[model samples]
Target: MKDEIVVITGANSGIGKAAAIKFAAEGYTVIMACRNLELSRETQKEIIAVSNNDQVKLMELDTASFASIRTFCSAFKSQYDKLDILIHNAAYMNHGEKYRLSPDNIELTFATNVFGPYLITTLLLDDLKKSKNPRILHACSNIIKHFFDPKRKIDFDQLQGQKKDSKRHSVYKNYCASKMALLMVTFKMADVYQNDGVKVNALQINGAKMSKATLRKVKPHWRIIARIQNLYFPSPSVMAQHYFDICTSDKFETITGKLIDHKQKMMQQPPSHNPNVITQIKQITGSKVYPAYAANPEIQEKLWELCNSLTNKNMVTPSSEQHA
Candidate 1:
């Protein structure tokens, strides 16, 4: 593990910071990809001091911006040769009802939670492939199952907040939709890269205490309740232990395309698996979000084509073909 490399997004605080510390202590060269340079540097210093691991580093990365993602990826490739683990831990949750847009003009929640991770993973696929056992862990949400309504499906027409009059416009619903979409992609990627030796999985850090910075984003009325609830939650360090186990332990060596709960139990099936629903999601997002067991090759191909066109980056060809 001394030479292993791990990249964690949103590493300035909360779960990402804890995971970085854990990985660094275990002798991995941990890179904290964050949006705030100053905060990330401070956290980097803290991790190095605590773990006594000088290999810990920081890089500026804004998941909400495609340009930033591209820049970060280029810098990473120029500096590093291998990436053993990629943890998609960054997320954004708007407290108000109004919708927000990213620099790329996409809905901010979707841009941060879904599109960013999708693009980053594909962009870094080559580096990940260089590792003997590369793993991609998505920090998904348990709120997806709790909030998902079985009767209602994703409305692709309103995916980009194009229909202002749409009734389902609350921030809570938007967040849930983003998380649901992420889960779908998680399953799809696990299948797509399984043969290539990249393992993909999603997990939720259930019952973990959120950082004060996150709680401050909550509305004042709810913030009090949240603070009280947080008192009973486990520390981020405990949650990091679970993440570290999933990433490195021999117990998960053969596990690939599964949704593991906070307790490390595998969920038999995701919340929703309707082909029509999945297809509609793919059509709108230009990405496939479905379980590996139920994947449609035709749809996946089209989604991939759309992604390459949208990002102006060709990922269909093997990395060796382009880099060799």
Candidate 2:
């Protein structure tokens, strides 16, 4: 991991912060992409103290806004020559409250969990290509099944948060929607870039400690609700070790376009990984991507266009070339 130039979004705390420290321990030059300056500084100190890796630096990144992502990417390119690994670990889920709006006027949940990481990856594709066995690990969740609907569409317009007049909608459902969009997006990207050596895959990492991000957003009085909500919080650092293993795992150098769960690399089954779903996602995400089991160029194109429109980012395209 020492030689790896790794960048992790929302790296100041929780799973992301833990992953940064672990990577630093393994000798990787880690860029902690975060939104808060003071907090990021504090986290850097803590990480440096624990790992003694001064190579760790904070890069301001707020994935919800394209402007923020552009700044982070440009600043990163100015100093670093290449990116060996990119972990799309930072995610957004505002529980115990109604959905919020991002700076870009999009739903906060969609912006943070889906749009932010998607744009950053597209902007950093060239840098990732510079690595020998470049890997892209997307932080999905086991909670995705929580959002599964037999009537769901890969290109469903409402999945991007146009909900209204529905009191039945819960944070749990919305969070899963965000991750499902991401999962589909990962496949789109993997299809385009897997052959380029920049392998992009998603993982269901459960049992991580509560993220400070989680702390920051929760309403003051909602702590009780939050605790009850998080009945089974896992160790953030331990789960981050799984992230570290994936980012640093030599065994996965050639592995892409697969969903990894708790160290088990398994094939995504029907309906979820169906060609129709991939098609919808590609059209929505603006990437001609496909699943390993069923690669279809036509469907990939349709999904990409839809994705591009929803996010309002020009990075609606991807190339699956496994390289470096």
| Candidate number with greatest TM-score | 1
Q: How accurate is candidate 2 locally (lDDT)?
A: 0.72
Tens-digit per-residue lDDT, 1-324, candidate 2: 367799998888788888998999888999999988887898899998999899999888888877778777877877778999999888777666565667776667777888788778888899999998788888887666543344543334444456533465566566776776777777789888866778888777655546556766777777666666567776688778878777677777677776677655554544444447656554333322223222334544555566577556545322222111
| Tens digit per residue, CA lDDT, model 1, 1-324 | 499999999988988999999999999999999999976787899999999999998988999888888778877887889899999999988666576678876777878887888888998999999998899998887666532234544444554558555555777777876776677677779888988899898885565787888898789988888899899988888878878988898888889877787678776543344447765554333221223322335544544444445556523323332223
lDDT of each: 0.77, 0.72
Candidate 2 error regions (>4 Å): 152-155, 158-170, 211-232, 270-303, 310-324
- Candidate 2 residue-wise lDDT at 74: 75
lDDT of 2 at 270: 41
Model 2 error, position 265 (Å):
3.4
TM-score of 1: 0.84
RMSD of 2: 7.7
Error of 2 at 148 (Å): 4.3
Residue 249 of model 2 has an lDDT of: 74
* Each prediction's number of clashing residue pairs: 0, 34
